[model samples]
Target: MGDGLRLALTTYSVNPRGGVVHTLELAEALQAAGVLVTVVALSDQGKGFFREVGVPVRLIDAPAPAPTLEERVFQSIATLTEYLGEIGDQFDIVHSQDCISARAAARIRDAGTSYRVIRTVHHVDDFTTQALMDCQRNAILEPDDVLVVSKLWQDLLLKDYGVHAGIVTNGIRAERFSAGISELRRKELRQKLGVDDRFVYLTVGGIEPRKGTAYLVEALARLKATHPNPPMLAIIGGHSFQDYRAYRESVLDSLEPSGLELGKDVVLLGTVSDAELPEWFSAADGFAFPSMKEGWGLVVLEAMAAGLPVVTSDIDVFHEFLTDEDDALMTNAGDAASLAQGLARLVDDEETRRRLAQHGPTVAARYPWSATAEQHLEVYRRALNAR
Candidate 1:
């Protein structure tokens, strides 16, 4: 392995979305660890965030004005080829996130450059037939080291797509998520949210179909019916429904007739700034995330780090980091009754919640960004050796 790796990280967009945040956090951590890192993005939304964190960012041409159906295919190939041809020689390793950048990185590797190509699969769905067609078509020609965030994703890549990938779980910055907030700040946050002394159930993620927000709402409704002192559920993060708008609308419509007060019982605060997020986690009594599909549930670790008990889905990926009836309470994904039961256990039993909260931070400490970056450094070395 070289003395210090010069890494070129590529992604479609550097927006403040979950995947973008993962890329930025990893890049910043790697740079702090003395690795020379350059972030290359197709869009500029997250450029400021990266620069503010002291990471060098390069934004490619303005995404070529959102292409139509016929133009989309040709434009994708052209844009990727153009970007790689222009900047492929500047680094020792090209680490790509998401499918588009993966294909681009593969193309650069195929060009016979000295730079080694590496790709990280943030989500298993990225390897689906319709999702990563370009990568599938060119993967054989453009061989590169693949990295996946979860064992579930790694297995999907190997079993479904026959692609070998190294596993590097996503991590959070523990210091930033620590429970050292002043009492004044906590009180201010609670006052701002109108959350008095009642227990709060918090879930943070985009409001999308895959995120299972509707399931969360149904569970909250169920909890209200059964429990005398039901905690309020606060959902953070905003999303575009687009074609899925009908489902979101239907869920809202159903909630209206369910006899549950919106602000009183359930509140959807949409997107929140990163600074405001920790206080939300700190104020919450327990965390509930019953997402049906996720590449990595980084929020679960964040909640745990904030000293909040977690109630999450019993999926293979989630189980890889959290155990059933241990650090987190696992419930059936997309099942409102199961989710409600899981939340009820945490709500009704204060001692159990306290016990889980006490143990949660210890488990979360194992997944700091430094460890995750070290793992990626190893992968970069392997890619460079292969080259």
Candidate 2:
């Protein structure tokens, strides 16, 4: 993998979400490895984050006039053609992050261009009919090479959708997250959040049904009633879409009795910045994620890197990275009682939390961005060589 390879990655957005983080870290690692990489995003907000990280971002502008349905269709086609022409002479490969971007990249490659087309499928489970349709469409027009984040996703793509994809588990910057701040800093963060002297159980994700926020809240309520001193639950991240926003309000409404007031027992810190996440992770006694579905639970690795004990759903994707009673405590997904019990055991038992926190860093260290970048390099090379 020489520095001569020029690659362009296409994604929908560049927010600090899991997909955006994966794209940014991969691009940064590739650039560090001497590859000339350019990121192409649909939104300007996504481009801004990449630019801040020192990665070159080429954004496809929205339609000049207000876009009707027909105009939006035309705009997408026009942008794909324009981008293909603009970078055709400069890049060796073009990789798409999801179905929407893959559609455009596939069209460009079918136009007899020189650039090789690749696609990385981040999610496998199609919860809705529309989502299944999208996966089917992507399978129909699959690119030269397909990358999946986990073996479960790979199997799902092939067995269910007939799309052949290789596995490339997500990675994190272990060194950057390994910075162990003083216990005082952790204490101060908890104090600032009004959770001083209370066990903190942190859950980081958007307030969506698939994320199982309802289950987590129910588990918290259960813990409060069962335990003598229940841990304070800190739910970070914001609701981006309208459905989730409504669902979040409903969850909050249900939690009024458990002291849903802001900065109290149940705190919803909407969208914490990247800089502030480390302190919260360190301050928390345990990390709880009862998400029903996850393409790859990157937050689990992030929490482990920060040396926090994890209590997550017993999903296959999570099991690929963590083991029950070893790296994390696994609970039945969508089962509030199970989640609450799992969290209680970790919170009340200080020695158990300490064991998990101490051993988690060693497991997390194996998943650095450098290794992930090398795997992606091989995928790009294979895509370039494929007919």
Candidate 3:
């Protein structure tokens, strides 16, 4: 405990999704606390996710590309496992953030004589494909100690696979996002994005079944009845390592409706740079997240930190950190009417919006990266000592 914990983190992608973001921040925080840290990921892209970052990303590029997700999954595991030869033996705690990395970590641990493997199940996916399902099962069960972002995910692990995962909730960079932008910066960002005096209802997750992209489109369309001058919906996300490009396009085909029109009212800004993300959050009037499922809705915390009034899905994972009326407005994910009403409440009521915004920064401030790193260290120490 005096010197440091030798921690090596493995994430599924060298991309800017919530899990990868968590891995980067946690590694840096631990490094600051005097721990020796290394990060590894399976790479499909040539560029690293961060521009100017402290921790160096070690990307294990696959030898040959695959046509489907199943093949990609196998290739990622094989590539990372083979590459693990160089870095796997140097750490006391080898933690994985996703399934592919978990499989790779297990392979490394089984082959090598050193290091303990722990898997952080960001969220449990009910995958239809057999290969993907087996990958998830092996990833969860093979690890020594499992970690999850929310109790809901932990409960899911227990019910479905009978594995109990430790709950180390996801953190937000509150100081990074919680700070208000200058009026000049705000005006510049608004003009640059071509978003006029419109009240922007922002959603950040890319199009997917779990993300409920279709449901939010319907809800935004339904909001037209109550909020006549409806907010233009801005979705800012890209496809992750998952092969969801086809899924995204299929969901987009369903977007043309009464109130929501693509290229006009509904703007799809596919993934903003990390440096510019806070500004995008600052420019928004409201944050809308109608996800069918979530581990802990990291974007919701980020929106709250930025002091935006939130209208998110009323899932159990969200309920873990956020209150019904106190943190943000919550709506049933399946019901478009309920979701519409939630967004309408935020749009119509100025006082309620102010209430959520004012209290949100305070809530976000409580879960900094330091706190998250501390929880991770506690678990790491327990694992090391037990070994």
TM-score of every model versus the real structure? 0.89, 0.90, 0.95
Residue pairs clashing in model 3 are none
Can you write out model 2's per-residue Cα lDDT over 1-387, one digit (the tens) per residue?
A: 544898888775556667778888899988888889988876642236533665788877644533343344346546655776667667788887765567777777777677877888777434345544664466335677888889888888778767778888788887666686788887777877786677888888867887898888888888878777778888888723113566878888888776445457788787777788777887787899888888898888889998889999998888888889889999999899899889899988878898889888998988888898999888877666774
For candidate 1, the TM-score is: 0.89
RMSD of each: 3.1, 3.1, 1.6
User: Model 1: which residue pairs collide?
Assistant: none
Best by TM-score: 3
Overlapping backbone residue pairs in candidate 2 total: 1
lDDT for each candidate structure: 0.76, 0.77, 0.83
- For all candidates, the clash counts are 0, 1, 0
Better of 1 and 3 by lDDT: 3
- Model 1 stretches astray by more than 4 angstroms: 44-47, 61-81, 126-143, 239-244
Where is the poorest 10-residue window by lDDT in model 3?
A: 44-53
By descending TM-score, how would the candidates be arranged? 3, 2, 1
Better of 1 and 2 by TM-score: 2
lDDT of 3 by residue, 1-387 (tens): 316677788887766888888899888888887788888877665656554558766876655667887888898888888888677877788899999888888888888648999999988777779889988899999999999988888888899999989999688888788777888898887765567777888888778878888788788788765665876788888756667777787777777646557876788788788888888889889999989888788888899999999988888888888899998888997888899888888888999999999988988887898888888888888898888
Model 3 stretches astray by more than 4 angstroms? none
